[model samples]
Target: MEKDAFAQQLPVEKYTRNIENKSIFYVIRKEGDLTKPNFIVSYAWGNYRNDLVMTMFGRLMLLMVGLIVISWLPCLGIARYFTRPLVQMERHVGRMAERDWHEPISTSRKDEIGRLAKAIESMRQRLVRQDRAQQFFLQHTSHELKTPVMVIRSYAQSIQDGVYPKGTLNESVGVIMKEGERLRYRRPEIKWEMDLAPHTTLIGDQEQWKIALENMLDNQLRYAKSCIRIVVKSQSLDNENAVKGQTSLSKFCISNDGPLLDQAIADSLFEPFRSGGDGQFGLGLAIVKQIMDHHGMTVRAANQRDGVSFYIEPGKQTDKTSVPKVS
Candidate 1:
């Protein structure tokens, strides 16, 4: 192109030109005097653009590869950190399903996973305890049942052989009847003297309460001489026995004119299969204790001057009161 045509078309600095259907990038500058002459420097724009695009694309790919390499280890570590506990929990649950409760579950983490592990461990411990208790109960029940069965069989055999085991036919038959009563789980007849307050409010499962009461009365009647006194009254909670946010509670007291219990026997009286030196099934007091504990109530037995007394009272006060009616 002519110099005047370049001056007319191109400005100072960089400019684009098309020649022979090819893009060209050029720059112009004055050689000597600012207004006298200018020189042009030019290069192919399409080739430069292609090279620049390829350089950027190569750098971008290299950066992405570096980022992936750097992130792989941490991502794997994070996945294992979360999945390790889940795998352990899955094994523990499988063991539990197989009824293998000997192995204890444990986790030291303080997150939600740790809390779940603690709860599962608690459940496993409870299952272990219950299994042991059931086995013990079955063993004791078989032994207890065996004794009464053997006595009845021996006495009947003696009667069939025209032999009097207790020295006379009447006495032998009475022995058989008493043994039958033992098998029948009969409680001895006693006069019930109740002094329950009017409108006394005791809240719990009705059927469970009935079972607990029956078991308690059976235990008391076995040792009682003639009278069993049941008293239901309301009493204010003392500081020691006071539950939070409670002012009063209802008390149930049952007393029997029975022989005093030994301190050791009295201490563990409510434990399962604890016999009181008598040939008796000792599950009654234990049943009462279970019922009381389920209802958040407390039961205690103490030796009185001439008898034994059992007191059952709520551990927490119900808002409903058991105030005696003013007559």
Candidate 2:
């Protein structure tokens, strides 16, 4: 039984051949003394060493690859986290520039990109408000202009038919009633004061100036708590821009004792149908602006301690006789 077990442990037989000769060798060893050997075995040291080195090298390469993969995971996550918001922001800004009014992006990130997103969203909201205000302006403009036009047309037709239209009398009555109603309704009993520049005139359509003044008065009436003042004065000219014989400019100001206008509202007041305090469409000021533009005059609104003032500056000189006096 001992000999059989030793045979099972022995190395398989092998041989090597060379040009010189063929030979056989067995690599064997005994656990005990060589002289009293109990077991021996054949082994190939060169092949075994080669196999071991190959296995070790393959394992080392696998370890390097795994380490690289593990390290790359966190790097990839960080890069994506930082750049994703930036990419989204770029796309969103492009859309806004194109005037695309899509819903704003929602984000809760507490980073720079998040702040940028919030700012962009705010701008979009402002644009939306303006857009809504523009729609309101169009609707109001249609209604306001249509009534007057229809009434004027009807009156002209009736007059052409040789009929002394009842409108002529009714219109006068209507004006009187409107004035009476305004006096009763306006609070604080607004006083009217006029400081006219005698014979201050420009070469422009008188009718247009009348319309501009009426519009200004209408606005002042709506807002005035105590008094409305109209002042006309000659503006001294700069020597460089004025012709030596040119007449001085006539500066007209309409002021009211009312609440001061906000700086933002004052800046954009003359823009057609701009939104105003209480969301009222500013068509009155717009009309004033249009008439002023036609006559080559500049108009601006300014805040005062007690109220607001609007000034109209003439663009050119005209003979003093051309200007009409205000009652």
**Cα RMSD (angstroms) for every candidate in the order listed:** 10.3, 11.9
| Candidate 1 residue-wise lDDT, 1-327, digit = tens | 345334654355666778788787766653644466656555557778889999999999999999999999999999999889989988998999999988988889999999999999999997887677667778877887898789889999999999998999999989878877775434456777899765444455667888998888777777888888998886544445345543333788999998888998889889876657463445788899998887778999999997999999878543323322111
Q: Put down candidate 2 lDDT per residue, 50-139, tens digits, no spaces.
A: 778999999999999999999899999999998998898788888878878567877898888889888888988877777778888788
Error of 2 at 163 (Å): 12
Quick one: best TM-score, which candidate?
Answer: 1
Off by over 4 Å in 1: 1-14, 25-44, 153-173, 182-192, 196-213, 219-228, 231-327
Q: What are the TM-scores, per candidate, against the unseen true structure?
A: 0.53, 0.52
Flag regions of model 2 displaced more than 4 Å. 1-72, 94-102, 146-191, 199-218, 225-227, 236-247, 262-273, 283-300, 303-306, 312-327
Instruction: Give residue 21's lDDT in candidate 2 (0 to 100).
Output: 52
Q: Candidate 2, TM-score vs. the true structure?
A: 0.52
* Backbone clash numbers for all candidates listed: 0, 1
User: Residue 135 of candidate 2: its Cα lDDT?
Assistant: 82
